[model samples]
Target chain A: MRPAVRQKLKRRFAETLDLPPSVVLDQAVIHIFGDSEVKIVNHKGLVQYSTACVKTRAVQGLIEVGGSELEIAFFSAQEIKIRGRIRQVMLK
Target chain B: MTQLLWLWWQGYLTVRLRGAGIERLLNRASQVGVALFRVERLTSDVVLVRMAARDFRLLRPLLREAVNGPRISVSVLDRHGLPFVLRRFRRRSFLGVGLGLAVLAVFYLANFVWFVQVFGNQALAVEAIKTAVEDAGLRMGIPRSSLDPARIERKLLESLPDLVWVQVKNRGVRVEVHVVERDEAESGEQRAGHIYAKQDGLVTELLVLQGTAQIREGDTVRKDDLLISGMYYDHQGRRQYGAARGIVKARVWYEAVGEASLVRWEPLRTGRRRSRYLLTVGPLTVPIGRSLPRENHLVTSRTWQLYLGTAMAPVSWTRLDYEEVEWETVPVPAAEAEQNAYELAWESLLAQGVDRERVLVEKRAVENLADGNGIRVTVRVEVLEDIGRFSGQ
Candidate 1:
């Protein structure tokens, strides 16, 4: 399938499950398929989606993500919260 | 303006800053191969950085990155701009530094002298004493630190034999030479002796004032005669030694005759005039007027003094003088010549210290010569007076 259609389907499914509407454009969820990697860019408002794992560039403005278990790493931003078990947060 | 230039040349604006963060900043900049200098950290968040114009431009970008990443503030300063900023920051400190340098310069230029004073003598010259001081290695313009007053006194005494004693003193800037000459003892030499006539003459009169004389009135005596003797014999026939001296008045005679030409050349005054101005420098004078005057006249000169070198006095011009010449003719009469001869004879007697009452004029004659210069005159005179006397005792 097309990466954009896949991203739209994943985002709609997450919203239908009553996770949060913010999850449609605020979440960077990486799904590891068998041979290819998929990044579900939910909260960043990106028009094109990539099928391979890629690093996120610095962005301005606020994006929100809601889930019972969530984890994120912030390098140069403020007010980053992680609700799940903090697996690792390393700074270089 | 001069003061500002002096302050600039003294390296007053050169700033050196030091701190632990400065070392770290320099190391970091060096790692990046950036030519940074004069790095200083005043506080944990404040740092001062200096570099060349090109290097500062290149480091501006990296410095901005460091400011953002390290969360520290940095200021880059040029050499000229640093002094003004630092002066404002520490005004009292800079003023103190400037005053200290001025005081040091004054101390460097000050001249001083250490001297030794010699006193209690009169005949020795002050210059001789100064020469003795110079020989002892103490002289003008020598610093006070190098001179030892006690050592100078010892050396001066060793060098000068005429000085009775010397004392060293360190006056402010001038070495005064006070000297005294050694006094010598008097010798016992006799001052009174026998007086004797220098020539033989007749005793015309008696003008005795002191002591008894052997000769009576109108007695003739020869030279070396004992006119008055202080040798007295006692009743036991022993001669007593004493001072023998006396004055004797005697008659003496001589003759003098003189002849002089009536016509003589004397400088005559001519009513003529000329004036000139001169420019003088030191010993050299250049006349600034015309070389020749309208008439051939005598030139009388006077000198006027100009400026003394570097002294504040008015210029003076004194004219230096001399004269030029010609000859003219004048005539004389025989009566005039005889009168002139009598006048000359009287003047000659007065010049010779002869009493006017003791001279008797007898004859006068005048003769005209063949030359244009006038007549010659001859005069005869006779005088009798007591002319023999003794002068020494």
Candidate 2:
């Protein structure tokens, strides 16, 4: 009935069924490739974009990517591809 | 790279969005099933993003709605991919037509034979094989569709009885003909024979591979003289006769005579010249210029033909240059006349199968004619070569 109760039940079922948290808990999957690219799968939308930083709305919160020459290589309803000198990834 | 190609194939544009909340525009575009790529913030209020050409119309409403906060104006920065390329090509249709014609030319020319190659032939003359191939209708400039490799192979096998197997391959513009000649020994057609001297020579080297030596090295032999006898004694000391095989190399002398006149009539170009052009198709010739006088003229002609790669077309262009000449009596110097006579004699000696590389000695003799009008020169060359010729016993 409540949003917290619904999330807690979903996590418990995911743990019991041995399912991945990103799939069952409705969380964005962040994949970092070396230091030049970051792929946020199951993303919500774009929040902000800059050459030095990029932010995309994920299921949990805002996924912020910080680097030099940061670019949103691709932005779709399903994913956000960020490519640059990726130094840090933060959830806000 | 594949993603970039797909975007290009679908046609896309880079647009500069002049607004504060450009990310919202991208998010809205994405929510409406329109993909955006290469999003970069140029300044605080301006962002550049790439979207499919078809999705730009869908974003017009979104841009208009953003006017309430900050006027979001869109301007195309660049256009890319197939749709734009086709539009440009539509304006200049000649380029497309030229490209199409070039491709068609290549396709059409590929159907004609550009080269005829023969392979895997040993103990058979290349010219002979080429002649047989041409006789079988597989030659340069022949259409690939009309060529039946099976029929050509059959014809080659029939025309050249020595060829046991033949394969005609049509490789694009080139036709490759492969032939396997029948070996006499392998076919059990080896004959019992004696190796004899084919010409008069002094034997220098003798090797008995399957024969008894009839004459030793350094011995002189005449034409038709037997050098290796087929008769021999086997291991059991029994007399046996079979095919005799051996190499008999000898020093042979070739002689030729050349004569030159002391006084000769030489033709000199009189500085008057005429030009003529002719078109030749197969054996038919059509003159394109005025006919020339028949007598006292030296004619030099050069022929030009159309060729695509290695294939020759049937048509040819010929340019004939005629120079008027005047006959003048010139006295030949003794030394120059002798040199000319020697060159003539040497040419004849080469025609008699004299190996220039193997020549051990050369001698020249000059004799003045009795009438004092001409000089006769004789050339003799000695060379080492195999003089063995097999004769069936």
Candidate 3:
């Protein structure tokens, strides 16, 4: 099947089974704690990292976090935790 | 936090990477399960990361590949955790040996009795109980493994006839010896004895528990006079001898004399005071200042001695305070003199063991001196008390 059709089918299946979209679609689960920290589960990899901004590749697109003194606290195959003054979280 | 602790327990290293493709390096490292943590970018091309020490060796080849392929520089900043700590101590091995020896010394010393304590002993002497315990092979510094508390208790009960029950408790480094003494009345057994008068008194009450009553109530008896006899006749008229036990309450008299001068001389402070110091080493006394005769002065001396640990040294320093006094004669009224004499006489009576609660009657006599300079007083008190003394035959 095509990628678009597969994603549509996974979304419908998640709604029918009462399951989370992230679990069904293999999507990145973003968790923001106030404006200081962000945790991304099922992350792909780090694309670009700097003090003011951190950009990571997700399943469908790229996740960019803009803030001051942004740091990649830790990263594994499963998740990535970013901490600092996270002013904006943009999905591209 | 648990992950951080786990990483620390497994040992870890902080590596600083100076390169342009640090992000790719981190992504590749995480993909291979290297667990890159605390990835902070210092500059555009400089980043610091932390990874487990075990993963560090695996990362070495990857680092060499990165250095050769992408020209990345990897330098370890710090090494932490138990493995590195042990590696550092491998040089100063004597310190570990000393610590082990110290622990061994403590363990060895703990196996010996350091303190021997006696409890629940009122009538029995503590030193006598300790002596008994020492004789029973349980004393200070004795090995705990060699101690037999039951045997010690048995030996203590055997050696001290006064004790009815004994218990020896070995508690860690302390040995506790508890003893219960036999009551005097309860211990009156088959030993033949006679109950005698402890003092001269008129017997007012008598109750005999054993033996035969030799003295009746209201009978006057002297000290050492037999009040009860161990010799008695049974119901079959056969003669028997046993311990004599009885309570003999009596009315005893105590007399005391006191004298007071009518013209009393009082010492008045003359306001002249002097102080001198003296150092005494055993029997030798050395004066620290000018020594003056202590005549006609009230002297108050305080002594301080040097002590080494719990033992006192022979060296001592004394500070003597002397206040000069002058004697002045004051005329005392007869009534005041008689009152003073009475108080003094009563003090002497009380000192002779005359119980105030048991006192039935008191008598005092006052007489003027032959030269009319002083008065003499005599006081007498009678009290009801037990005056029985048992003499074993």
TM-score of each model, paired residue for residue: 0.31, 0.58, 0.48
Which candidate number would show the highest lDDT if scored against the true structure?
A: 2
lDDT winner between 2 and 3, please give it: 2
Q: Residue by residue across B304-374, what tens digits does model 3's lDDT show?
A: 96654443444579999988998899999999999888888878888888888988998889999899898
Residue-level lDDT tens digits of model 2 in A1-92: 99889889999999999999889988999999999999999998877788888888876889899999888888888989999899999999
lDDT of 1 by residue, B280-379 (tens): 4323467766554423446666666432232212223545333334445345555675566667765775676556676544555556667845555555
Regions of model 3 farther than 4 Å from truth: A30-39, A47-55, A60-74, A81-92, B1-9, B19-21, B37-47, B64-71, B103-110, B115-132, B159-166, B169-393
Candidate 1 lDDT, A51-79, residue by residue in tens: 11112321223322222223221111212
Greater DockQ among 1 and 2 belongs to 2
The number of the candidate with the highest TM-score is: 2
> What TM-score does chain A of each model score against the native chain A?
0.27, 0.93, 0.94
The DockQ-based order of candidates, best leading, equals 3, 2, 1
Ranking by TM-score: 2, 3, 1
Report lDDT per candidate: 0.47, 0.86, 0.85
Return the lDDT, model 1, position B172.
42
List where candidate 2 sits over 4 angstroms from the true fold.
A1-6, B1-6, B42-46, B123-128, B158-162, B182-212, B215-227, B231-393
lDDT of 1 at B216: 63
CA-RMSD of model 2: 18.2
The local lDDT score (0 to 100) that residue B257 gets in candidate 2 is 91
